[model samples]
Target chain A: MSYLAFQLKKVFKNKLTPVCLAILLLLMGTVLFMNVRTNPQFSLQAGAKSEIAYRQKEINRQQRLLKHDKQKSKTEVYHDTKAAIKQNQDAVKQDKQVQKAANKGNWRKAYTIMWQQKKQEQTISSNGQDLAGINSRINVEKKLQFFNYLHHEPLPYESQDMPVTGWQFLLQLNQQYLPYVFTLVALFLLTLLLTDSYHQKLDTAQLLPLEKNNLMISNTIAGIVLTLGSFLAINLVLFIVASLIYGTGSLAFPYIVGQYTGGRPLIECISTGSFIIKVIVLQVLTFIFEVVLVQFLARIFRDKLPALLIAILLVPGLNIATMIVEPLRKICAWLPMTYLNAVDIVSGNLGMNYQNVQLNYTSGLLTLCCSILIITIMILLSSYIKYKE
Target chain B: MLTVQNLSLKTRQPILHDFSYQFAPGQFYQIAAENGSGKTSFLRAVTDLIPASSGKVLLDGKPYAKNKRKLFFFESNEWLNVNLTSLDYLKFVKRQWHSNVDLDQELDLLGVREYVKVPIKKYSLGMKQKLIVAMYLVSGAEYYLMDEITNGLDEESRAILYERLNNEVTQRNKCIILTSHYSSEIKVNNLHRLVLHKQKMHEVKQ
Candidate 1:
């Protein structure tokens, strides 16, 4: 058998590896279950209703002042309630349930109706240099939905106060969070398969019949395959278990994808399956990059603990660097790690919120591809050199 | 046949310089050196674990690296995956080398036949060493580079290893170069000894 085959067998048979896998499953299950217990719609409704309440109070105060002061004209009272009325009119126009409830002046029901809309798309136009930014966000959504159809990936329904379904549980886990969770587990599995072994130099694998490059490549291939296999296996199990406990829900549910710059937000409703497919593809790309990255660290460090530490730190370090450090904000969008939270990148929020950085799904894909290629070259170059040197 | 032509290595200070040697089939050479004398470094360099500062290793006029399948280097006996069973290790080696060496018989020869299914971590020091020796015996490689494999073997197991080494030299016409020398090796026939002195290889009558 090939060394790769032997490694796969050994990894699966290894005692502690299985326990680690169980821990990952347990973690994912807990988080997913917790999300289901707390309806996300309630939070959205609460926030919107709170804003409306505050606005209504201002309007009442303005009316009371107008009644007491004969010197003040009715124009001032109308101006005070103008902003609140316009906001209410926009909410009512966007959602039918919101319109019905808003006619009765029920801000809470209107907020709930808006959040529970069958589909939600936001359109933002870009007239300046934001054209690329707009396209990138739209691409992420297109790719997400397109790939879902390609891969036949199922997605969960949006979180509401109704009976929670397995699909709904998955839906609540935004693209931003799933990538992190998947990458964390991917890093661990890659550590198990490559970096840890290379770090200790426990085996004279270079002595294997294959060439040094081929050996590293074989190990790389095995690590990626196993990591992906484990990732999918855990997700499949989670989905099935969720399905059993909370019904499969609808695969045909609508997913709202949007692009906004200066123009009205252009939002569209695509099948949930399509949107999830993009998430799966982005995740696969992240896994590939992650596998190569950890292996690169392993070959450089030639010791398990240090390489492992660096790999773990890398995930959050990139985020903290770009987000927390003010100087790095401008270039953060150009980094592959920024796309580590692919959903936010796909939705253009990573760049939109930063305003300083310009990132979209395309930029994310490019950065990831470049990183993988450069790291692969480094792996090949360092393969010919001594592990310690 | 295997030849090391002017093999030299240096880490910080010089360890080995102007090293050259040749070995033919049906012969065994014992290399003995003091601690930090570069016996282990020499083995590691030749096996490509550490790159040599200069010189090249060849087998029958071809670079040894390109034809790595013909040589087996057991760098360290202790640095093995203990999660694997003895049989699993043997089977893995067998598959890699395409060797038809009998697994059960090799285990029986080393008296570790009962623990083929047991994880190597649970084995006594002697047992793990026996497994290491068994892997080399079955590797089917023409040239063998074993570094300090006898560090933990018991007396009877040492005798078994010598017996296997003698068989490789005589019957199989294989070249076995092992680091360190023990008195028990005296029984082996057609054996040569080389000692490392002053950053060089020197042949000594044994």
Candidate 2:
């Protein structure tokens, strides 16, 4: 049998592997059910409709006042009210057209109209409710556009019952919990598989009819296979389970990427499908890089526990390190650990809350690639020297 | 045949200095040394487990790189995983050497037949030692390097190991290099002894 197959079989036999797998599924299931319960899918469509209804009622009231014989002379409040009524009427007329276009599956046009509506709303007032209404219009229109892009249909919106999208639920679940789950799997299950050669005295492996490089490469491949396999499998399972319950949401939905500015919050969004894909790719790269790292540390320490602890702690440690250490903060974009928190890293919001060090997807990908290259070289060199002696 | 020329090893200090030896088929050598006197380092240096400061080791006049599969080295039971059963470890070693040796027969011979399926962690030190010896014996390699693996075995187990060592050297015509602090425990006839003192070997008359 191939070495990778052998290693995989060995990994399967490990008690930790099964335990960690069970934990992963349980954690995902719990998070899915909990996120479904709370964060009750806020209705963007409802917010917009309410705004329109409010404006129309205000317009009717102002028209009635203009016709009534209450006072001949108009006060400043009355004139302001009259102007507001006209603006509201025009805004409502434009939004109705946008809604009509949206219902006809023209989400992009709807989004454009909502953006204009927001600009119009901003010009009139910065009142929180008005801001929220405009924001809702844009957000809902974008979701509808995404729904169309993903499934090629007008978005079927939720009313009081707020229908939760399965894909959206899974995506939210992943954004918050995947990193921790990935870390646990890496630390508890995968690290031991790699480090056991030194720690548990599996050194008898040296006598295997394979060369040192082949042995190390085979082990690394086995690790990648397991790590990537478990990560994808967990996601796939959650997707199916969630889809069955909540209905698969649009992949084209906007992901709310957040950044902090001087104690204030800023939010923007990108395509959900691309966002999820980017995260998965980066996270897989991170697992491979971490596998190499653990192997390297095993070679140095010649013990599993130390290597395991170091590899597991290194990710979050680096994230915090970038905060306290200015130099590390500056170069965090080039550091592999910065990419471990995939959601934040991909959105350039990794250290926004703490240090404001922006990390883009491209930089995170490039940095992780460089780390993999360097670690691969180190592993090969170590194996060669080991065999050469 | 195995040959070592000008072998020296150092880790911060000279662990072994200019050590050298040769062994033909059908020979077993017991290398003895005081603790920290470089006996383990010498065997490790010979097997390329650890790098030599200066020297070359050859199996049949070819360096270890060429005939690595024919040279078997085990440092005590360091390669044994306690989580694995005796039978599993035997199969693992058998695979490493690409052999068809029946692991159960080896286990029976080593007196671990009753506990072959039990985890090594549950076994006594002597049982663990016997299993290690059984594993190495099944390797069928032309040259065997053992580093102080028989330390905890009982007299019966040690005798079994000695008899197997004799068979490998006499019947199979394989070379065996083993290390021990108590050289008297080795009962193989026609034996050769190398004592390490202060980083050098002194050949003792057999």
Candidate 3:
């Protein structure tokens, strides 16, 4: 067997490999169970009921204003009171239409009513008369565009429904949890694999007739293969299980990629499949970055526990730091950990959260690649200098 | 030939100060030293495993780094990754050294065939020792820098190992430098033994 194969065998044979895999599989199973119990399906009737409730509250407030505020203009108060009451009555009538259509399983008609109401809201908000602010206007516009898209190309499953098939389950897992899970698992596996030699008090391979650099490169390749390979394998297993249980869901399901802050466009979207592909690409880069980072830490500390602990803690620490510290948030475009949220980054949510328009998928891709290159060069240089001396 | 020039190694205090030695092929040399006289440190330093306080080690008149394939130094069984099978380690060393030695034959000769597939963690001390020796033999290196390799071996295993070392040196013209606390345990022909004292090597018997 080649050295790399040998290294991989060592990692595979490690007692920790099975333990990590078991934990990950268990977590996936729990997620699957929870998804079954709680459904996130969007209900037009439920939405209309909430809208009616909101309008009723507004009518009550206006009535109270007319009764208590004698100092104000009576005509203005009366006008506000009449408008609020009319709006509440209109909401009640709309709620009845939604309930009647929903009772007949006519979701399309209910959706139409909901969409027309949103269109009106969008018009009023755009006209600057909604009084909710620009963000509210953008939100209404986004929903209107989404409603139009869904009407034209409806999905077999509602876009917001709890994942019903393997594809959706994988997509959901990738979007909601896998970014952090992938990085952390990679961190744990790579750290343990690379630092095993140190913990052993000796690495028999280091005594082989190979250059230190060659050994390091072999180790790094092994670490990447084992960690990333495990991730893909686990994903495949979960996908298969979920797919068998629920027929594979549509790839054409729409995913809103957040409000398009770049221009005056309402919001952007792509097929859920496409969004998932982008996530995988960014995540692969992030994994490579993590493997190198772990190796770098192992080299620095030269102790297994310290290296592993630091690597495990570093991701969450940097993630929290970028979020809580305003200065850090502003500079997060260059911070590699900011991209660990590959789903958020690709979906444009991370960019929105950081308040930095530059933290998108493309920027994250570049940042991760650059970080890998820089750390790799540093590792090679340090190895060269140490051996040279 | 392997040559050491002005080698000084220190840890906590100086161990070997300005020590020098030259080792030639087709000979077996025993390195004898007191408990704290840096015998193991010297072997490690020669292979550049542990850095010397000063000086350089050369193989065939070139630096050791350039001639790594020509030298084999399996420091101790403690270096073994107990999670792996013995065969895994044997194959790794063989690949790294690019050796043509038959691994099955080596395993059989070392009598590790019975537990060759078992992980090192399940092996006895003597079994682990035998696997380490098997790694060295499979490497096919010209210079062997072994440290107390006979520690956990039974008398029969030691005899088999001594016979193998004799053939490598006399027939293959290989050079062997090993350290042992009990010199009486090694019975080989024309063994050149040296004692390490006062941070310098003194030839005791040839």
CA lDDT of every candidate: 0.69, 0.71, 0.79
TM-score, every prediction: 0.79, 0.77, 0.89
Off by over 4 Å in 3: A40-111, A124-139, A159-161, A199-205, A211-213, A259-266
- Reference interface contacts recovered per candidate: 0.55, 0.20, 0.61
List model 1 lDDT by residue over A143-229, tens digit each: 344334323432322343332456545654445345666666667667766753542363367678876777877777788777778
Kindly indicate the candidate among 1 and 2 with the higher DockQ: 1
Per residue, candidate 3 scores C-alpha lDDT tens digits across A1-389 of 77778778888888888888888889987898777665443355556667777777887887787777656656776777777778777867877787787678776666677678788888778777543566688678667766666556655434354674777788778767776776677787787788766633433445566677777788878977887788898889888887787667777766777734664433666787888889889888888888889888887787777887898777757886777888998889888888877777887776765567787888888899999999999888877876776
lDDT of 3 by residue, B1-206 (tens): 89989999987678888878889999899999888788988887887766788999999999887888999987777777888999898887888898998998998987889998899999998999999899889999999998999889988999999999998889988899989976887777557898888888867844
i-RMSD values for every candidate model: 2.9, 3.4, 2.3
- The pairs that clash in candidate 3 are none
Candidate 2: tens digits of C-alpha lDDT, residues B148-195 = 877898777778778878988888888888898768878785589988
Error of 2 at A97 (Å): 14
What RMSD, rounded to one decimal, does every model reach? Answer: 6.8, 6.0, 3.8
- The prediction achieving the highest DockQ against the true structure is 3
Kindly list the per-residue Cα lDDT of model 1 for residues B132-205, writing each as its tens digit. 88888777888888888887987777877788789888999989888865734546777888888778888888
Poorest 10 consecutive residues by lDDT, candidate 2 chain A: A153-162
User: Could you give the candidate ranking by TM-score, starting with the highest?
Assistant: 3, 1, 2
Q: Give the per-residue Cα lDDT of candidate 2 at A33.
A: 71
The DockQ-derived docking category for candidate 1 is acceptable
